[model samples]
Target: MPWIEVPDFQPRRPAQAKAQETRAWYSIKNAASEDEAEILLYDEIGGWLGVTADEFVAELGAITAPKIKVRISSPGGSVFDGIAIANALRSHPAQTTVQIDSLAASIASVIAMAGDRVVAAPNATLMVHDASGMCLGDAAEMQKMAEVLDLISNNIADVYAAKAGGTRDEWRAVMRNETWYLPEDALKAGLVDEVMSAKQAPAEDEPAQMRARFDPAAYGYRGPAEPERPKPGPPPARPEPAAEAPAPALVISVADALTETEVAALRELAQAHLDTAPLDPPATTDLDELADEQPDDWAASLAHLTTPAPWGQALEHLTQTPASSATDA
Candidate 1:
């Protein structure tokens, strides 16, 4: 597929208020003399990475850069987006540089590894762990999840190993431990090539407040040339975030959230996965929608379950909401 340039989504900034997730932004200062460009990830709302389908690869495309540098300061959002952008970077032909100035946890780590050159500021951090996503269904349902998880584990391993130049088993061991590595330690683990001191970066104090945060427009980059946004159509009804119980020793599925087709999907996904093989879990859609469509007639909804997993890895990289009881209500 051709790369689609999209508009950036970021919280508007006033000089007075501090930027929430933006770590910082820097440019080569000269377009001709400077062959370098940058990608920034700092979305305020946890969802969407503050970017949408149209906005993907916004920064990477904006600067017309041959040597791309991505500076990250994000808490992390949907793993789907993280991997999407990371995959985009992998496809990049230029010399890519990924700089971690702050925390790169969860999916952010994938983005960090997209770089051919990965560097971290002294205080920067990196985290690795098992891939996770919300799930629905019963015992048979959960059995399927194991397979999908196995695949996600491999994908994650491939990323770290490619960047770290380490064996996959050793890398998997690092993820199994699920530890966050600070700059010095991460370098020791071969996750990064160098940890540059503040002096190594351009001369100036990055205000804790500024964090060099700015909207995509402020950076002199507009991913794709788009006209003013049209007014939104009537707001679609929001889906309920079915209240989840505290992490149970075992994750139990709520009947209201799972129906026949969903149950079957979970079963198929699980069956596909062997002890070592990883399968991608099906997507979490409105089970209510699935329930209404009988499997025989509905291709998109009910039948969606039994089909090959909707996606290889879950787009929503979070845990399934455990069933919440009446007391919470």
Candidate 2:
């Protein structure tokens, strides 16, 4: 027989590739109400054909376990989807516990905030930065996007503040600097409840193991760099208390940062911009038309665009709802 050359020919596989081996997003296992639920959020946050709020809701809704454990290792993805997933976790009727097995950077860190009790492995990492977006349009459109990003950033900062008991401005500063937190730093910043002890240390799983979409190194990450050690010095004497202790006083003042009308106008503007040019789109569309076409989707997108407090509220409810139900049962 003469040797023949084949064109565009390939051998068939004996079996289909596992979803995890190819897909950027996949559920390791599904849990029922009675089972100890475990959700593995390992990979990109969004902006691909991976996990979405709808998928997360579907998977999470099936698991009615009183307490749910979430293991996270992601470089982060779409800000839009990030907030949505965070909200879903927050609203779930389970006592959510998050374990940062390795890295939770960008929006992944925001999702971690949904946990009632978050624990990070000894060498785990967390990062936060201002919400980012890419716009394609004239100066006006760019300005519109900048304004929207500001709102989104503020909302993210609020999530951190709500969980960590810090002012939004303080969190904003950290985001501005693209701050990264080690396990100990995360605990002090209220990003995590505890750091895993040596005995409880999780096995090493490098970033490549995830096969995720986003790159953790994009942020120029250098792992958890340690602070310089202090030089040895003599112990100082303790200072004495003040001669007279000041009496504590309480006062309440109501302040309006923006008038009601201004807020409504800003919200309407945000909605209008998001519908037609959320990132980039055709020139025109009526706000009412967009809302009427897909009200739930529109509202959810609006919620993500406007602020993050609603997500926080959902997490708060999830935390309390499970406790209340357990007590009632």
**Leading candidate by lDDT:** 2
| Model 1 per-residue lDDT tens digits across residues 1-329 | 11112125455555333232322321223222256665666542135334332245554555566777777777666666678778878887778788888888877887888888889987898899877655567776576676677677788888888877877788778888888999999998888888998686544654442454545677788688788988889988999999888785865665445566655666676665443232544343676664464343345333435654543333222243434323334
Alpha-carbon TM-score of each model against the true structure: 0.48, 0.52
Which stretches in model 2 have alpha-carbon errors above 4 Å? 1-23, 28-34, 48-51, 201-329
Clashes of each: 7, 0
Best by TM-score: 2
* CA lDDT scores, all candidates in order: 0.65, 0.74
The TM-score of predicted model 1 comes to 0.48
* Location of the lowest summed lDDT over 10 successive residues in candidate 2: 1-10
What candidate 1 gets wrong by more than 4 Å, as runs, is 1-34, 44-54, 201-329
Q: Lowest-scoring 10 consecutive residues by lDDT in candidate 1?
A: 23-32
lDDT of 2 by residue, 93-203 (tens): 889899999999998998899998999997999999998767777888788878888888999999999899889899899999999999999999888999989685344
